[model samples]
Target: MRIAMIAAMAKNRVIGRDNKMPWHLPEDLRHFKAMTLSKPIVMGRKTFESIGRPLPGRHNIVISRNSQLSIEGVTCVTTFDEAMTMAGDCDELVVIGGGQLYQQLLPKADVLYLTLIDLDVDGDTVFPEWDDGSWQLQNSVTATNDKGLQYSFNTLFKKC
Candidate 1:
């Protein structure tokens, strides 16, 4: 299966603050839903909790160290490896994030779907730093939100 990492980060790489996204971008949320719908999405426990429920129309796979934890409409796995294994015959597995999951899966990801928000906000969680040399930009589309926030949807492929 192909592994992909999807996230929206600010100019400073901040992804979340206080267990929630620091900014509200409905366009990005719509983009996320459209891209991930019907795909198997794997995320860490914190990411799942932040979302509060299983994302409809996609297979929800949550990775956590807690073996005994269970949630309706979600599959719980102990490790990233196990989560991938459980994804089965899916052509792509999108790794949704909380930070640590992004850090752990970056090296294994074949593609990155990143939304670059044009702002620097204070946050405790950050997207892991990655080498631009390792990824080739495939496409980008710039957009502006209703609140005047500018962002770009970027697709990058791991360079061969």
Candidate 2:
């Protein structure tokens, strides 16, 4: 199964703050839906809670350390291994995250779908840095949202 990490980060690599995204870009939302449709998404419990519900048309797998935690309409796991086992033989599994999930899964990702935002925004959470030399850019397109925020939708493939 292919493992992909999808996120939008600001110029300063801020992906989130206080359990939420620091900025909203409609175009980026569209891009996220398109890329993740039909795939099983694995995220931390906080990430799942932040979204508030199961995303339609896809399976949601959440990892949390809380043993008593359970939510209807989604499978909840206590560890990453359980999440992987639940993911099974899917064509692709996307890690849609809050910072902690990204940090844990970065090394295992086979591809990255990133929305590179142009502005530097304040946030408590940041995306982890990676070595650029190990990945090859597969596709990229820059577009400006109605809010006039310039961003690029980029897909990068991890080198074998």
Candidate 3:
């Protein structure tokens, strides 16, 4: 199965603060939903909690070590490998994040779907840094929201 990651990060690579995204970009959210629907999504427990619920039309696999933790409409696992095993037979799985999960899975990803926000906001959480030389940019679409937040949707494929 193909493994991909989907995330929106600021110019400083900040992805979240206080367990929530620091920006309000509805267009980016819509794009994320459109791209991830009907696919299996693997994320850390914190990421799942930040979202507050299972995303519709997709298998929600949350990685956590808390064995007793259970939530309706979500599957909890102790490791990233377990999450992948649970995803079983899928054509593609999207690694939706909370920093550590992104870092851990970056090496295995075949593609990355990123929304590069123009603002450089302060945040405690960040996306993991990777060498740009390892991935080839496939496409990009620049857009501006009603609030004047500028961003670009970019797709990159890992070089062979």
TM-score of each: 0.98, 0.96, 0.97
C-alpha lDDT of residue 21 in model 1: 95
- Report lDDT (CA) for all predictions: 0.95, 0.91, 0.93
RMSD of each: 0.7, 0.9, 0.9
Give the alpha carbon lDDT tens digit for every residue of 42-133 in model 2. 99888888899999888899999887888999989988778889988889999999799899889999999999999999999998998899
CA lDDT of 46 in candidate 2? 82
Give the Cα error of residue 157 in candidate 3, in Å: 0.7
Which candidate number maximizes TM-score? Answer: 1
Candidate order, TM-score descending: 1, 3, 2
Candidates 1 and 3, the one with greater lDDT: 1
Candidate 3 structure quality by residue, lDDT tens digits, 1-160: 9999999999999999999999899898899999999999999889998899999999999998898889899989898788889999989999999799899899999999999999999999999998999999999999888888889999999999
Q: Rank the candidates by lDDT, best first.
A: 1, 3, 2
Candidate 2 Cα misplacement greater than 4 A, ranges: none
